[model samples]
Target: MMTHPSGLILPESRLSDLMREHPHTIPVFLRHHMVCVGCWMSKFDTVADAVWNYGLDMETFLRELNQSAQSIPPQGTD
Candidate 1:
């Protein structure tokens, strides 16, 4: 598990749980071509596991994920 500065999402966070908790971060997953959005493995996988299996650099991926989260405006305030 990686520590995110924003602490909004971390590499150890469960994909399904993250989606449920922070739907706006979906773009990050799509950008990475991740299939966890609709995959059963999401129930058991964490961001770290996905990135590892996908052969992605954890630091870079987490940076993008956090950035995606930061870029999205809060709901009802847009």
Candidate 2:
């Protein structure tokens, strides 16, 4: 199993909850063309499962997810 970016996300983490908790990550999903962003299955699928189902590599996906998370400043920071 691969490590996720941080508390921001994890492979075993559910996609629906992640998006709801971290809206900033939407770009990462979009960049990868992950339909799970709006897919009903996102509620039940983990990032690991979703990536694999979408034919994506776990490490690469995590990398992009981390990068996108880092790019976005916190809600209070400017």
* Model 2 whole-model lDDT (C-alpha atoms): 0.72
Superposition error at 3 for model 2 (Å) = 12
Q: Per-residue lDDT tens digits of candidate 2, residues 16-50?
A: 76776667888888877778788977888888898
Clashing pairs in 1: none
Candidate 1 deviation (Cα RMSD): 4.3
Position 6, candidate 1: lDDT: 54
**TM-score of candidate 2 relative to the true fold:** 0.75
Best by lDDT: 1
